[model samples]
Target: MLNYLGLPIAASEHAGEIDHMISLVHWLMLLMFVGWGLFFIYVLFRFRKGANPRADYVGAKGKLSKGTEIAIVVAEVVLLVGYAIPAWARRVQQFPAESEATVVRVIAEQFAWNIHYPGADGRFGRTDINRVSSENPIGLDRTDPDAKDDLTTINQLTLPVDRPVLVHLSSKDVIHSFGLFEMRVKQDAVPGLDMPVWFIPNRIGDYEIACSQLCGLGHYRMRGFINVKSEADYRAFLAEEAKFLTQ
Candidate 1:
């Protein structure tokens, strides 16, 4: 169903539900389009100038018309209250514990995504705005003990398949949207807000991370990559990054 709609593959645990909701929305839209088209044709013929030379002052007082309008409103409300709100609540309220999930920080800047990993210590270091530079975009205080082992990557996110990923999302400058189409995840990275987005990747593959919002002049080229690997390979990636940090 997702492929038919030109959507990316469903790769996350909640992707199926998200796809189902999308399909339902499309079905409703199709029904509405057809229904309205038929109504329009009926109106054109039923109120032709040849049939009724005089115009009626009171328009559309029929029960059928009122009933159809009510039905459409009810359908929209059901989608919002039943599916959308529950899905949103589950994502925001039922986050996996930080100890159990793969925790990372995703900071969005003008045209880049700064991926930050807590490394072996599993603790994020202090970041000062004054310490920010072209060389060190995230402003990690390397002198701090926790910052020593932290790893930072540019526009690259690697995760192990079948594990819940907890991302502390923020923005350095303007608002940016962190979007992983395959995961059915899109969250805003606001400048002053630290938002949490969690998803469990069930597939091991490469995907794209797009900035869905029109953020800046360079927004067209603001993109990132997501590499979902096996558990063993994921560990090896961490080891390689750790070694690079030492140098």
Candidate 2:
């Protein structure tokens, strides 16, 4: 159904549910437009000057218009309570356990994305703002034992397909939005806040990540890529990155 509407490809497990909700809302909106428009045209023709030369002081009394308004209100109520609420609850409240999922941290800045991996030990290293510089974007404490194996990358995210992945998202200077359309995942990266987004990529491919928020003069160039690879390939990529770490 989404393909017919020219929507983006569904690359993750949650894409189908999001597409379904969007289709429902659009279909209802279209139905309302065509249905109410025809009715309005009919009313205008029925009360034209040729039909009623003398105008009535009081408006014509009828229950049809009132009933139509009531129906619209009920439809919106059902869409909110039935569809929107459940979808949000399922995504935010039903996150998988960190131990059972591959965890990564995405730190957004003015014009780039910083991807951090906890390496083999599964523990993030310490980061300090005072140490931030052109060479060290995230200010990693290489002396810290936990940070010795941590890997950092710019503008690229690599994950294994068919596994639950959690991203701890944040921004360095201003607000940014991490938008992965194919995965149907979008979350704001706010400064001083750790927001989490989880997803399972079912397809192995490369997808684009756009900054949905306008940060500054360089917002237009804030682009990233997500590489969904097979489990073996993902492990190989991790090993390769680990070897390149300066620590």
Candidate 3:
């Protein structure tokens, strides 16, 4: 059903659940559309001018109409309370521990994404606005002890499959939306605010990170990539980035 609906492949842990809700919503809409269309046809045929010359002021009334209305309301309530709220709560309130998850910071700017990874020490380096430049987009204070092994990349985010990935998202300029369609994750990256988004990638593949918001003239070009690899390959990627730190 999801494929028929033109949805992308579900790659994350919660992507299936998200797609299920979407399917349910669409099913409900289809039911309503068919039911209403039949009702309209019935009304037109049952009350034609030729059949009933006299005008009837009081509209038709029946248990079927009332029952249908109640059923529709109940379906909507079930979707909201049973599926939407719980799914939303799990995404927002329940977060895996940092020690058990792969954590990274994604800073959004005009036409680019800066991905920062805490190196061997597992501690993020200090950043300052004054130190920001073309060479250092995230303003990493390498003089700080924790900053010594920090690694930064432009438009590239790599993570290990089958583990929770926690991304601390922020915007440098205008608001941008971090959209991973395959993972069914979309969050607004607002300036001066740190938004945390987490998901577990179960598929080992490459996915595109799109800026869903119309942020600026270059918004169309503000795209990134997420590479989900095995645990060993993921560590190797970090090691390769670390080697560049010394250079």
Candidate 4:
């Protein structure tokens, strides 16, 4: 079950329904190759000099090979409408909400990622590009009173295990990508629009996050870590982050 990339077969979120869709695509391609191969082999064997020694003069005279044509059309319809359409629809649907869900915001820059978690208030701080400076990673709007309480962290993100988490992603300069290779989730973080992604971590572990788009010379260095911890550990991490913001 090794993949073409020589990677071991996935058995976790890395191999979720998305991976299954990829497998189905490969299988369909293999079927087409086999069918075409057999057709060529049959032609070579049946029409060789030793067998007929002459081309069929009526092969192209509107012979109406209706059965083969109909079968090809049917196979195409099944693959498109039956398999591909449903899988795409499911992925585009919004993630389900649970009673206990966490919200996190991710902002992408040229060569870094900034993560923001709302404090106990559950409201994102007001942000203004005009007030942007080196100190304010998220460019909080000082004039807006709501910006006073937002907590911001850089380079690292943390999540609680088993809780439904929603991530709102955006890019500051150019188009970027928020992708978790292990989680099997990736989406474009466009500049003007905020893209939302959601997932629940079933296990406790650290995962890698990368910007899949070519943003700048340092695009390859735009990387971060996501630590999914137990409920207690997640609270502790949030407390520590709050301390940094208050100071």
Candidate 5:
């Protein structure tokens, strides 16, 4: 699982459920493959010319094939409606009310990612492209009172363990993919639109964040870290970030 190319399912919030579904599908496929393999081999050995030279193609178009086809279709429908649809719906469901979820925004540029926090007010500042500058690359609307209190952080992202987190993603230039392999979260960050992705971090560790989309020359350098810390450490980190932003 760790060596797989895609995101790891070990530490995901829905790891248990997702892994169960994945394993079920895998085992079903394995059984089908082995069963068909052995059946073909048995037929080959039993129907050899020396064994049964009289070729028998009787009942080749019998109701057995039709029943098999119907069974396959029914199985596919059941899996699609029962497993696939439900899994996807569960993935997109908003965080529960009992969980005090954290909201963070990620703005992707040509080669880097800019993270924004709403500060203590829980409201993001309006942004304008006309006011974009080197220091204020996100073009945050500082004239607004809400904008004044909003805190912006570049390259670094921190989350609290066992807390749900909703990340709003966007892009300033081309398309970029936001992915945290360890948490099994991946989404496309597109310009001119905001995409919302939510997840809960169950593990306390440093995870790698990378842009899975190939936008331009510096795409390879688009990388960062996700630190899932204890609640106390997360609060401390937030306090430190707030101070820096205010200053």
Candidate 6:
């Protein structure tokens, strides 16, 4: 269903549910279109001038039209309450445990994404706006012991396959959207708000991250990459980053 629907390759385990929801909505729309089109055609032929030269004083009325209208309303209500709301609730409200999932902070700026890892200590180092510089965009307090072990990368995110990854998303300036098509994850990165998105990538590959919202003049360049790797490769990446941090 996914491949034939023109959707991107969904690498995340939970993406199938998203695709199902999309399919359901499209099917509903198609059904409505066909039903209405046929009704219009029938009306044009039934009320043709040749059949009735003089217009009837009373308009044609029947239970079928009322029933169709009621049915459409019921279907819409069911779709909203039973399907769409539940799907959104699961994505936003039902978050996985931080201890069980790999967590990272994704900070957005104009035309760039800053990826911050908590290192071995599993703690984000202190950041100060006053210390902000061209080289230190996040303004990490390097004097702090925790800051010494923290790892930061530019537009690069790495995670292990078969495990949930929680991304704490925020922005420094205006609002930006973080969209990963394959994982079916899209969330707004608003300034002064730390939103979270969790997903489990079942396949090992690189996926594109696009900003669905137009934030600035360079919004087209606001892109990132997610690299889902095997467990061994994930560990190796950690080890290599740790060495770089220590040096």
Candidate 6 lDDT at 226 equals 94
Error of 1 at 131 (Å): 1.9
Residue range 156-237, candidate 4, lDDT tens digits: 8888987778888998999999977766678999998888887767668777789999989999999998888999999898
Indicate whether candidate 4 or candidate 5 has the larger TM-score: 5
Q: What is the lDDT of residue 241 in candidate 5?
A: 74
Give the range of the ten consecutive residues with the poorest summed lDDT in model 3: 1-10
Going through the candidates in order, what is the number of backbone clashes in each? 0, 0, 0, 0, 0, 0
lDDT agreement with native, every candidate: 0.94, 0.93, 0.94, 0.77, 0.81, 0.89
Compare candidates 3 and 6 on lDDT and give the better one.
3
Error of 1 at 164 (Å): 0.8
Q: Which of candidates 3 and 4 reaches a greater lDDT?
A: 3
Better of 4 and 6 by TM-score: 6
Ten consecutive residues with minimal summed lDDT in candidate 2?
1-10
The parts of candidate 6 lying over 4 Å away from their true place are 54-60
Off-target runs (Cα >4 Å) in candidate 5 are: 1-9, 40-75, 95-99
lDDT of 2: 0.93
Pairs of residues at least 3 apart in sequence or in different chains that clash in candidate 6 = none
Write model 2 residue lDDT over 205-233, tens digit each, in one string.
99988999999999999999999999999
lDDT of 3 by residue, 24-84 (tens): 9999999999999998999899999999999899865889878988999999999999999
Where does candidate 4 stray beyond 4 Å? 1-15, 45-83, 97-100, 142-145
Question: In model 2, which regions exceed 4 Å deviation?
Answer: 57-63
* Residue pairs clashing, model 2: none
Q: What lDDT score goes with residue 1 in model 6?
A: 26
Tens digits of per-residue lDDT for model 1 on 1-247? 3465777888899998898899889999999999889989998999999999999878788898899899999999999999999999999999999999999999999999999999999999888898999999999999899898999999999999999999999999999999999999999999989999999999999999999999999999999999999999999999998998867
> Best-fitting candidate, measured by TM-score?
3
